[model samples]
Structures are given as C-alpha cells and as structure tokens.
Target: MLLLSLFVQPATKTQAATDLGLTVDAAILIDASTGKILYEQNGYESLGVASMSKMITEYILLDAIKAGDISWDQKYQVTDYTYAISQKRALSNVPLREDGSYTIRELYEAMAIYSANAATVAIAETIAGSEKAFLELMGKKVESLGITDYTFVNSTGLNNKDLQGYHPEGTAEDGENMMSAASIALIAYHLLKEHPDVLDTAKVTEKTFREGTSDAIVMKNWNFMLPGLIYEYEGVDGLKTGTTDFAGHSFTGTAVRNDQRLIAVVMKAVDANGEGSYKARFDATKKLFDYGFTQFSEQEVLPAGFVVEGNESIDVIKGKADTVNIATAEAISLMTTKDDVAKFTPTLFLDEEALEAGVEKGTVVGKIVLEHAEGKDYGFIEGGDLTVDVVTTENVERAGGISLFFAGVGSFFKNLWGGVTDFVGGIF
Candidate 1:
C-alpha cells in the first residue's frame, strides 16, 4: 500500500508593493491568479464607469453563447431603435445597416474590440428580451463576482434617463451607471482568468462585419493605445474604453508581457481640459504595469495535502483503525514583493479534537487556518475524519482454545460490571 504523507507549512506573507499611489481618484492592480491586490487607490470609491460596462456585457454575451442560449452562426435582425442609437456620435456605432443581418460572433467582435453600443444593444435584446433585462443580468453577474459597489441600469452605459426614447445622444443629468476602480479591475481579472479566450477578441485591433453582405458596416477599434502606446509593451491587446460628459472617463486595459499578464483600471480620469482622455488612461496603466512586473512576483503559499502537525489523525474508538489522514483540499499561491516571499507559508488548524473510536469515513474533522505575515487571514481550509478498516493481507486460523477462553473471560467481566451498575441504580 502506498502512504500519502501530509506536510503543512504555516502561512506567511511574501514581499509586496510598499507604495501604490493614493492620489488617483480611483485605481487598483491585482494579481490575476490569487486575486491579491498589489496596489490600490480609492479601490472602493464609486464613479461613472464609462465603456467599462461593456466588459460585463462581454462576459454575459459569451456566457449565453456557451450555454446554448444563443449560437454564433445565428443571424439577428437590427431594430430601428438599435439603428438610430448607432447613428449618434455619443454612441459607439458598429456601422451596421438596418436589416443587415449579422452573426453573434460578428456582434461580439464589435462590442468587445470596438465598444460598439449598437452591437451591445443588439446582443442584449436577443438574449434577455430587452436591454433592461440584460442590464439586470449584468448587475447579477457583477454581484456574483463578489463586487458590492456597482449597479447597471443599461446595457450600453447610456445613462438611465436616455432609456425614455428621447435625448437620443444620452443625458448627463440621468441616473448614472456606477462602479469602483477595484470592481473594474476585478472584471478584467475575470476576463483573463475565467475566460482567457476573451483575449482572442480583445487583442484584435480591427475586424469587419458581413464582408459578403451588401449592407455590411465596418467597425474600427476604439482603444487607440493598443497600436503604439509603449515600446516595451508588446502583445498589448484590446479592451473597452468609455467616457460620458458626466461619467468622465474610465478604461479597463489588459496587456501581456512575456508570460505575465496584468489588468488595470482608471476611473474619473480625464484629459487636459477633462474630457475622457485615453492618453491619461494609457499613462496611468503604464505606471501600474511597470510597478507590478518589476517588483511583484507570484509565490506558492501552500501545497495540496498539507498536514497539520498536531492534528494529523484523530483517535476513534471501536473502529478498525485509530485515525485517518487529514489533509487540505488544494494548494494556495499568492503574489507578493520579493522581500516578503521568503516568509510565506500555510498555517492549519483543526476546529475540534479527535473523536473517541468508531468514527466513520468522511466525517467532519475541523477547519484549517491560513495566514500571512501581515496577520491578514486568507481563508479556512477544512479536513475530514474518516475510518480506515484494518485488515491482514493473509488470513490466519485461530491458534486456539486458550486464546478463545481468555477472550470469553474478558467479555464476562465487562458484562458483570454492567450488571453491577444496573443493580446499584435499581437499589437507589
């Protein structure tokens, strides 16, 4: 039989960013693998998250495609309202021709790479019956991501008041679509981590819809920073860029450098005179990416089956074996600065002590605790208390009457003790 040895190291903190800027209105940088925030500024601060809303739209649309709710090859009819909205300068039009049918894949490209409002609304109406229902779905997806500071009132981020069918260009005084810088970063992280394939769309600098169709419209990429923003930055892919008179400017940009990928968000930032400046977004992203790549490194904190020294096995009574293997469900890793990486480790704890024998397999043992050098708790890792029956490989016949007689005598004494206790209780 092979034995599985469990070794658990105490949790410790690895080195991390010492100074992430605090002056930015809202900014956040997180480790994609572990969701650890390396640098943050006004992380929870809420502001108008312009085209960044499309990131959520991208996620929902892809989910529907995969779930068989919609198919890429299926062509959709473009409504008159969808056409009118596409014509507005304030909106990012996909240049779609009315009645010019397009596939789900084509629409996705327009929405993801170009932040096309028309493409977004078309996809929204198809999946959720109406744009409002789609927005509700977007909000639900946001909540599922563990984000608490955000709300979605429309699929296109056109502001709530524009839904009235008037003020076609959208309104500044409308109920604003809101989100935090950290939340936007989280959305980016989700795209890369959960749906890496999204890069296939985001990375594209250009694409055309309905090359064969007579009324096909051409779509241009909205994010200008992708082509030639930074010399060292290559494989810099595409992500949506958003700006409204009231929402200011917000951008969620992701780039790949060698084997490393980073996602960053800038909210409430504008140009020289304060008009949704993509340049500012580009510059801000450079600061975050440089800081992350140069100073931050990913490190494994715990390995699977990590054992707690004192709680390796629990004592069980009347069972084949006295104890069972207690181990973690999976390994944990985190991103930290170089200095703190050395002290990182996994700490385990048993919520309760071992049970007296006779415990069955798969019983709840206790929870394990993992911590960092900063004393921040990572999360609880749990273990199971199971009974392993002890059996001999080879069978042996009873060597005898004498051994049998001794076993009988022991049983007799146990019964006698029980009887005596019963008699004493009756007398009392």
Candidate 2:
C-alpha cells in the first residue's frame, strides 16, 4: 500500500498555464474544502465589489444570530433612515413602511435576495444600533479573517452618493465598497463553511418578502447562474451579484457537484470594449466552473497506513525483534487534472541512526516528500512539494544481555565462516 499522510496548510494561490481569456479585470476559482486556488488572474487587486459585499453582511448577520446578539424571529422597527433609503428610486429596496415592523428574518431575506439597501440599514441598526457601529464590526471581522485589503464603508455595497447622509460613518475616500477578488472568495468560503443553511435562502428563485400584508413585496434573486435563470448552470445556488457605474458587474458564485464545492469570483467584468456588461461576469464565472469540473478532479494521492515499498521494515538494533514494520499514519488527497496525475512522485527519507531497544510504536522517525514533476509548459503543483511525517508501526523491546551476547557471537562466526570459504575457493 502507498504510505500516505494528510497535511493541512494555508491555501496558496499558484499561477498556472491555462488561460480562459476572461473579460473580467480580476477573477479567481477555489476549492471550497481544501481552499486550493485552482485559477486566478489579478485576484488580489482591490476594486469595487458592489453587492457582493452583501455576502459579508450576511456573514456578519449570521454570526450575530449565532452569538445570541440577534434572532431571526425578533422584530425590529423600521426607522425613518431606513424608510428614506427605500424611497430612493435609483436604489434596490423592498419599500419598508416607516411605521411598519418586520422580523429580522424578513429584513435579512430582503437584503440577501434583493440586495435592498434600506433592508440592510434596518438589519444593521437592529444589530449594532447604527450603520456606523455595524461598519466597524464589518471592519473588525475582515481583520479577524486575515484579509488585509478591504474597506467596508456601508452594509449594502451602495455608492457614497446613494448613502450620503444615511451612513454617518462616511465612506472610504473612494466611496464604494472595495475588496479584492481573492478576499471576496475567502469571505464566501467562510460563510458557506460556517452557515451552510444560508444556501436555503440563496437557492430560492422567487419569494414574497412581506407575505399577505398590505406592503407585500415580491423578491427575486439577481444571480443569473441560478436554476430557472436564463444562463442557469448546474449546481449553482445562493450567491450575490452587484453592478454600479463605478464597479461594473461583479459576481461571487458557488456550486456543488459530486460532493465537491467551488467558489468562483469575477470582479469588474466588462464587455470587449471595457464597458460594464451584466452578462460578462456571469459568463466568466460559468467558464471557470466548467474548467474546474471538467479539467480537475480530487484523487487520493496517498493511502492511510501505507507501507513504504522497500523500507517497510527497519532493523532494530539491540531489540528483541531483528526488525519492525512501519507505515504512514494518515492519507493524503490532492486535486489535480487527469493529465497532471502522472506527475505525482514520492520519495521516502528515514532517520540514519539505528533504531535502539525499547522503541515505542507511532514514533516519528522520518518523513516523505511528495511532489509533482513539472509538465512541459504548465506547473499545477504549487511550490512543487508537500511533506508528511512517517512513524513506526510497532514497538521493539530491548533484547536480554545473554540474547545480545549470543546474537553477536553468531554474527561473528557466520562472517568468519563466509571469509574462510571465500579464501579457500580463491586458493583452489
């Protein structure tokens, strides 16, 4: 069996050879489970993210609820500030009543599905007492997540003009919500991993926000990749889309197929002539998903408890047993394309010192360096290496004094006899 051990490390974005001719200024594709970035171009450039910022809002909201800071069924009064934002014709909103009261769930659905600015303000105020406080929390959360490049000025991803007097915290000098394609991917990854049920809301194509009321509002998801949409892609579920004069069109899309989930982010996707195009972002995201599912696959590169072929057993110096068997403690799996699988290689390195008596089982004695040989042009293997520790599989007790003495005498006589035979044969 192939000796294998799984090692968890920070996912690093590795540059590869495949190019999709993307129209987006920045984009990235990442494996949700392993956090492996399969493809990326200008992924770290910070730019306007638009409504994709709502995903972070959703994360913050869910976290607050989980921490008992808020509840879904809890009702929050619609304030004058929220109502004013809802009245802005240029902005997306659910038209909340100034005097009307809605539950946290209602406001969250409005914000998540419709990207409603007013609904976002209502939820933010309810959670942190004001949009300013919520913005502070969002900033803190970004830092906690290890994201260095980001600016969260508003909860709804609305531009400064739209948020003018509403957000007392003002805006970043540039005004619009700014984040890199890579940071947005990390945000989405954390959201889904922590609260998978958010998909329950994201998957909904159409629903009534304030059902059976005089202010009943019909809401529909803007994500075109979702089912029933014009460019529906298989496995696409909940996510958000954003478009503005400054930000253009952006999307953070996620899908699951064969138990493998991937997150694809496209920021500032423009037309051939560099103009904002709604379809550009979605189309680019679809291309990424297609490339990931078709060209790459998850494989068990190493098996658990795999015994090293030639070095399955090592001599135990001064031990009761002459040698002891050894194997790896864990298994290692890698995501690679079929063509790249052939490049997988493993090399075993063992401790040169002799194994002494009373050696315990599961002792770390050596390690295996797993790597991928470079292909003709592209190198999918990041840094070209992964290291796993190897351990002993059994215990070896010290041999008694008499046993050791007899073993030494037997070894000397055997060597003497062999030398005598060789000498006599040479003479003859």
Candidate 3:
C-alpha cells in the first residue's frame, strides 16, 4: 500500500448535538450511502442495548438462511425455557403453546415487529440449538466484523434475570447486552446493508399473528416513528426499538426523503425533566433526523478523473512512456454542511503493483478518500475509510531494451549523486 496526502485551504463546519440539545445519553446519525458520521454525542460509551441487539441476531439468522443452513419456511418448536419466558404476558410476546410448531417466517415477524422475546428465543434455538450456543455464533460473527467493544450474553437482549436461571453461561445473572452507540450503529449498519430485506417486515406497522385462530394476536411495531404509527414520521421505514429498566428507551431509525437516507440511533433518552419514556427516545431520534436532514446535505467531494496535484501520474521504470496517468475511478459524495462542501481534501493510496509498467489502461491502481480540511472527520462505523477506486487513465507499454538501458543509466546517476550527498553530510 502506498500512502499519499493532499492539501486544501478551508475550514469546514459541523453542528453538534450538544447545540441541538439532544436528550439521549448517547446518539449517532450517519449517511446511509457513504457511512459518514454526520452527528454524534457520547457515541463510544457502552450502554444497555435492550432489544436493539436483535438487529445482530437478525443478521445471523439472515446469513444462515442465505447460506442454506436454514430456511424461512423452517419450523421451530419452543423449548421449555423459551416457552416459560413467552408465557410471561408482561413481557412482549404472543402466546406460544409448548406443543405448537411455528415457521421461521412467523417467529421472525414476531421478533422484528412486536419485539417479542419468546419468538426471538425460538429463532435462536432453531438456528443454534440453544441460546447459549447462539451466543457463541454471535461472538464469532462480531469478531469477524471487527467489532471490539460489546457485551452480548444472549440471543434476546433481555437481562439474564429475565431468563429465569436459564440464561447463557459466563454472564452475570442480572446482565443485559451492552454496546457503545457507535458499535451498535455499526451492527445495524451491517444488518441493513447485508440483509436489506429485513425492512420488509420491519416496516409493517401492524399485523396479526395466526389470524383466524384462537391464539391470534395483533402485533403493533414498537417503533412508533414508523409511518402511520402513533408518532407518524413520514419517510420512515424499517428499524428497531428497545426498552427495559436497564436500557431505558432506545431506537435505531432509518428514513429517506428526496433520495437521501439517514440512519440514527439514540440510547437512554430522557425528557426535559430527565425522565425516560418511549416518547423521549422517539423525540430524541427526531432531533437527530431533523438535524441530519436540515443541517447536512450530500456534496460531491471528488469527481471522477481527480488527480493529485504534482503527482498526476505514476513513474514507469521500463515503459514506453515515462509515466501513466491515474485518477479516481468514480465520484465520491459526502454528507456535510453546505458551507463545508468545498472544504475536503482527497488523499490517494496507490498500489505499486497495479501501477507498474505494462499495466492495462483501465487497471485499478489505488483509492481516494476524503477528509475535512479542518480536521472534522468522524469516519464510518465499519472502521474503514470511505474511498473510491482509483484507476489508470491510460496505459504504458514496456520500453525497448535500448530505451531501458538509457533509463537505467539515468537512474544509476540519480541514485549515485543522492548517496554521495548523504555520505558527505553524514561525515560533516
């Protein structure tokens, strides 16, 4: 990997949530297209995630299905523990008979829509045979995703105490899954990007489980910010909500209006009086959404064919030409304040092998990523620099032996002079 840098002359702008007065312990808003953090506060501090952790569980299940290890029509039988947990009417659940076998589709609908704990446990058991084992799978998946800060103890995000001594081992009896706002946002980011179909069920505002049957129950989504719901936010679609004594009220929300989409998360939200309520979480999320939509807009940071100043081409050692022209393969747009649109510098990272002599005209040689000139880059949740491919704009053929001999002589003198100067300096 070749490192490159650029200079830009401007200071960009950012509007902090502190100025907006967000009422959450932690929060983050990101652009869905580029994964750029638009706003954040206390985003790295770990806190209870409640059922928002279900997004990770949803990811695993979807992956298993995609891998052919499981199927949507697969049947699941509730275990004694999951059955008992489901029987607690105080918890979010639809009645599940111990003798009943349900399809994975229906159970997933329960978990994603109503935040049903029992249905989640059943899905966990079906996929991994037990919640404890499923926890291991979740761990491996998290590690593979490069997440380093998290505490996941169960497939369901319920406190271990809620598991009735049947919780997964190696966790405190009273513990619930916890993750930093940035970390959980990363989880949701992966889930939405990897399995966007999760939105289909997540966007369902209300549905009846087992319609026309005695056990039928109406499942209204706990995400009140969704369209046609109580709070009724337009352009809102699929996402999750969570609530518990430990988690207070948290939400991961996504919405798109006029072709721009934003994902926002708020944890432990409180009202003006510092009291937690479902409304408080939604209200805080609204602030994030409003700030993202109003304070920021997408701007093309670098256009295709962008070339680094004074480094427009790669030096070719034995090519027909002295160098090959290379530039950004595509345009990159970032979500930032309109005033900050022209304040980004693109840093190029070149691939020496790809840029070598005789390389094809369209060969990809590097990548270009943008940073705010005034040092205001929050970066993406995936922990990777948002970049666009850089490719050769034209090719250079291998030079003839005679031309190579001449080039080699020039290179030798250049190196000899540099070495002589360094030797004299060192002696002096």
* lDDT computed for candidate 3: 0.85
lDDT of each: 0.65, 0.81, 0.85
| Model 3: how far residue 252 lies from native, Å | 0.9
Clash counts for all predictions = 21, 0, 0
What is the per-residue lDDT of model 2 for residues 1-428, given as tens digits with 9 covering 90 to 100?
Answer: 33333332223334567889999889988888877677888888899998888887889899999999898999989888888888874688888777888899998888888888888888889888898888888888888888879877788888867764766565654488898888898888889989998899888888887789778778878887899888899999968899887788999999999998899999888778877777888889989999989887897777778776677887789999988887777877766676766555666777754588788999887777665555222222122445577788889999999999999999999999999999999999
**Clashes in model 3: which pairs?**
none
Best by TM-score: 3
Question: What's each prediction's TM-score?
Answer: 0.74, 0.82, 0.89
Which portions of model 2 show Cα errors greater than 4 Å? 1-14, 306-324, 347-369, 375-389, 398-428
How many angstroms is residue 282 displaced in model 1 relative to the true structure, after the best TM-score fit? 1.1
Considering TM-score, which of the candidate structures 2 and 3 is the better prediction for this target? Answer: 3
In terms of TM-score, how similar is model 1 to the real structure? 0.74
Off by over 4 Å in 3: 1-4, 8-18, 348-356, 364-369, 401-428
Query: Over the full model, what C-alpha lDDT does candidate 1 score relative to the true structure?
Result: 0.65
